[model samples]
Target chain A: MRRGLILLGALLALAACQQTPAPRQALFVVLPGDDGHIGAITVNDGKREILLDRPYAASESRGGVTAPVQTSEVEVRQVFGAALAARPILPVHFRLYFQTGSDRLTPESDAAYRAVFDDIRRRPVYQVEVVGHTDTTGVAARNQDLSQQRAASMRDRLVRDGIAAGAITTAGRGELDQAVPTARGVDEPRNRRVEVTVR
Target chain B: MHKFVWAGVATLALAGLAGPAMAAGAVIGQVKTVAGQAFVLRDGGRVAARPGDAVQEKDVLETGADGAIGVTFIDNSVFSSGPNSQVSLEEFSFDSSNFKGAMTSEVRRGTLTVVSGDIARSTPGSMKVKTPTAIMGVRGTTFAVQVKP
Candidate 1:
């Protein structure tokens, strides 16, 4: 047991070596949305600090907002835009495929599911939208049912693994969104999949 | 906070609409998104960066070990830098109406992502994103640039 502890300690130290320092200075333009869902962050237990809900000019390590000595409307107006030309901004997206005609995850997708779970676990406030898709081989209605089944299956697994059910929203694409494009009635292994977007 | 960032931003928009165009060194952008502790070192003063804060030319943007930020320039171009990164806007000129101007930013270290906007679209070769190893000429495309630590 002591030897196992030592190995674990060594592994953690190795992981720690990969993290680089964060960049503090940047200029941004808020995209169109209610309160702009730019991104969310959670600090490591001791070393992380985050600034939430506001357009940040700069923030210190203790979550302190920096006051700009010089600022003017022409400067601000130069950046903020009219809502007329708003462009949609997208966040993180992950897709995992299912076994043929079944809601069960293929081996590769099972591994992907675990990786995504790790990401979800890191955020203090996060929501995931998971959509399931299927190959075009089946009838339209049946494909819809299978796709939803796959979504439900993944949701259930997540809940069983201690993730909050409320954190997830599931939908079925019914073979409508294919990862690898295929013709009608074609059985594309890549088309049978689930897409999870986490933010 | 004596004044909110959005309020400052609103006034800026009104000023432009009223036809008194800003001088060359006007605030060109705001800090759109920040995760973790990022800071701006300007004129020998250091300030913590938050979303909505105005950004100017020649400001040195730095990220702490756990910090990262996303910036939207006046021309609607987007730039994001990953942790332990350092970058600065070298030159910026934009006429919002026609999106006619050029932008140059240098990534001294770490990772950066850029999405070309109106300026690049209108003037195909108006923007250049420089990293330590190579100079990237952006022409209306989304791309990521990284420098090994």
Candidate 2:
């Protein structure tokens, strides 16, 4: 009876020790300030660090060493806080230009698209949520279609550039979700934009 | 003689009209993946399949209105169909011990992405997606299929 009791106690102790605590995985968003500068950000310990280096000058090619501007720490706690607050540091906005009543992308938007592509390419594993919007200058139905097409075009470009298409989700908000509210006939440059969130 | 011939001609025309009305096909399932649009019905429930579903030879599949579906074959390969697409499974068969079969699908419209799975690697040329414009045969890679209506 004594042996049995001791064995039972040992088994209970082992069970208690074997129990594993769940991992702490939290989502965070990097919110850029109005000046396009990211404030303090948080990330998990195991999460990979993002290196932000300044663009190399043409003369820097001759030198073997390139100076980095700064390094930011991404902590899990901050990530959790931001996720709770529903904001991100690097918020992307695309101003897609069209030939007046068409969904086709114009050449003027190419440079802007390249910038977006470069941002995505810099971080491969990041998932993106794309919301397309348009100015209220056109018919409601037409605006809806145009916005969707614009979002799709951006998605295709990203996919072609070797980004996983699955990681990106696209939605056309039409003129319903406007950045800058304007009258029906007014042209709102900010409204004709696509917002991309990388988290 | 002339009256009898006219009656026979009218009967044949009526049969033709009735045949088309009775030949309507049913919507078996829906597409639930990105850029994919094919699905199959099993046990009265829509199987939003990944590439891992065990398939036998001659399984009939169809796409939902969105024209996107996901499938995982026995070998764990994933594929998805886009919206407004339709694909009929021409053939499928697999066994864990012996993984070998052929799968042919017809994409009537929309887009599809085939991510090479185990089946494509083990038995090359066994998987083929036929579009209205061309037939896509998988070697072992990710490729998209788009058919314009």
Best by DockQ: 1
* Cα deviation of B140, candidate 1, in Å: 2.2
Candidate 1, residue B2: the lDDT equals: 48
Q: Estimate each model's TM-score.
A: 0.39, 0.33
List lDDT for all candidates, in order.
0.64, 0.50
Candidate 2, residues B1-149, lDDT tens digits: the string is: 99999998896578666555322233211222322334554433345544323333334444555444554443444445445554555555544333465566665654444444446667877776664433445554443444444
Q: How is the predicted docking of candidate 1 categorized under the CAPRI scheme?
A: incorrect
In model 1, state the lDDT of residue A45. 16
Per-residue C-alpha lDDT of model 2 across residues A17-105, encoded as one tens digit per residue: 89743331111122222444332211112223222212110000012222222222343222122111211122244556555555555
Which docking band does candidate 2 fall into? incorrect
Looking at model 1 chain A, which ten-residue stretch has the lowest summed lDDT?
A: A79-88
> What is the Cα-based TM-score of model 1?
0.39
Q: What is the i-RMS of every prediction?
A: 15.9, 19.9
Tens-digit lDDT string for candidate 1 (A103-181): 9998988988888788777654455668888999979899999999998998899889888997687888897777788
